[model samples]
Target: MVVLAVIIGLIFWVTSDDSGKNTANSTDLSGTPSYALPSAYSDPSASASGVPGVSGGSSGGGGGNAAAPGESPAPGEPGIPGGTPAGETPQPVPASGLCPDQNISVVLYTDKPAYVEGEQPIFTIAVTNAGLSECTRDVGKAMQSVTVLNLAGDRRIWASGDCAPVEGVNNQLLKPGQQVKDTIDWSGTTSTPGCETVRQPVAPGAYQAVARIGEKASAPITFNVNRPAAQ
Candidate 1:
């Protein structure tokens, strides 16, 4: 009886240890993220690799690397170890089948390269899959932003999410060379978080704009905000 009791205790200990290890190894990507801000929105003074005009970093999703059940990991595997049985085909996992950062490209654009003060501008944020395989990424409003800065780019003048942001999850799969886009309209005014401050119309001048989804940011594009007289 003592030997049997010892065996049961050992089993319980092994399972407990396994569960604990899994909890420790797992990452919660959906919850409030404690990670650093993506470089595109980050302050230039924070990092040495920051872009000249704007601070930088990214949001990229890579395919999961979960190993097959009961299988051990091998070398050179990417993402979550999707351990698959020998000779069996592996299927793409939902949400988790993210594209690697190196294979995703983010680009920013405006309907017009210039806008007059008090005129609204429509901006587009585009994400393209540059890889050869189909992979998924979270492109929801929860992961996107558009920011406008002065020519020097140190101060943030306007941001899409400053007042009221609609949050939702939108995971999409993209084939090679496939691109997806999101658009937002700027009110030609300045804003503060939570709508706490009265937004004022921006003066005519040169400005820079950038778009991003999570950590992926497009190169900054310059646009002119001219006096209505220049229109």
Candidate 2:
């Protein structure tokens, strides 16, 4: 009976060891397949020189194409390592032309050159709007006063009374493409009565007529007064 018990115990031990070995083999086969994994697929031999997928180590990491020597960078990528992208540079703005709407201009004129001493000479000044748009009453009325000054001879043209002038002061208005004519009469007595018979020549000199439009002064138009021969 003792020998038979020993033999039975030995058989049970051998069966138990074989069963554990079979369970371990089955688990290894059911687990993850190492051959199909990404690590095994990465061509470690791709690192030679210009190999496509060699630069960036793993797929999840950034691409390693740090702009080749002088070549331009890829789209959406920065030029230098730690610098700004291509689109960050500023762009130039377009220019618009000057005073396109106003199209404003000025002109000046005078009457006969010779006049009798003490006789008021009549001069005509005409203001016209050459622009396509109507010059409102405001500008037409703002023409303050037009005065003539004798730049040469002893005679002087006075604004007080010698000249009857209608200036476009505040509230003056001119219509578009319209012209308004105004007359200025100059009458002043000369020191020499004899000067009148000889056509008292207003000495040769420079004269300027300016128009005040809005708050700005229009460029002055220059003219000259001719002096008559001495009587």
Candidate 3:
């Protein structure tokens, strides 16, 4: 009776231990609970549709950079990179007046069919300042003058008292469009004939004496002078 009771007690103890071990193992194998898991955990492709730019969908369609899919490209600007256009010519500037703003008029006159080695030749030169606006009236009768130049010789000669002024023949103020005349008498000597003969004074060669009007602005007039026959 005592042995049977001990055996029964041992069998009960082994079965209870095995049942406890099986229950603990099953609990461990079941894994984490769904309620405790993060709801956001998922694959990128799993979502219904991707965000526009973030998902690599067609971006802004503009020409450069990352433009949207439906957008148009910008127009190109014009340029003149190489050079000026062909067959283009620049125009020249025309001459204004005789002396810009000054309403001044200058004229020269002389006799033609000139004589050779003759008396002093006479000429007339006229200078007119249209008005005070044209002429500097401030120039007193003293300043009112004329200058004659030998263009060929590059020489200059003047006569302030000999000519008319801007005002009267003696007045300095030259009114608008007023005219004044100067008579010049240029003499010719044996030493300086018109342009007849050459070779005598200094250089023995055919030389001609020439006279010009308006300080040589006018064309020069020439005449001949014959050399004396050999002794």
The lDDT for every candidate, in the order shown, is: 0.82, 0.48, 0.43
Q: What are the runs in model 1 whose C-alpha is more than 4 Å off?
A: 1-95
lDDT of 2 by residue, 1-231 (tens): 999999999999999999999999999988957674445454656663436755644456557666979899877845566664332221221132121224433444556544443345555555455454443434343343444554442344433222233454433344455666655444432223223332243444564544343433334444555455588
Error of 1 at 161 (Å): 0.4
Candidate 2 vs candidate 3: the lDDT winner is 2
Best by TM-score: 1
Relative to the unseen true structure, what is the C-alpha lDDT of residue 101 in candidate 1, on a scale of 0 to 100? 66
Per-residue lDDT over 61-159 for candidate 3, one digit per residue giving the tens place of the 0 to 100 score: 556564458977555587767965352132221243122222444455555434344434455655556433433322233333333333343443322
Q: Judged by lDDT against the true structure, how good is candidate 2?
A: 0.48
Per-residue accuracy of model 1 over 93-131 as CA lDDT, tens digit each: 346678766667888899998887789999988988877
Put the candidates in TM-score order, highest first: 1, 2, 3
TM-score of each: 0.57, 0.33, 0.28
Decoy 3 TM-score against native: 0.28
Question: Deviation in angstroms for 111 in model 3?
Answer: 3.4
Better of 1 and 3 by TM-score: 1
- Quote the lDDT for 206 in model 2: 61
**Candidate 1 local lDDT, residue 221:** 92
- Overlapping backbone residue pairs in candidate 2 total 12
- Please identify model 3 stretches exceeding 4 Å from their true place: 1-103, 130-169, 190-231
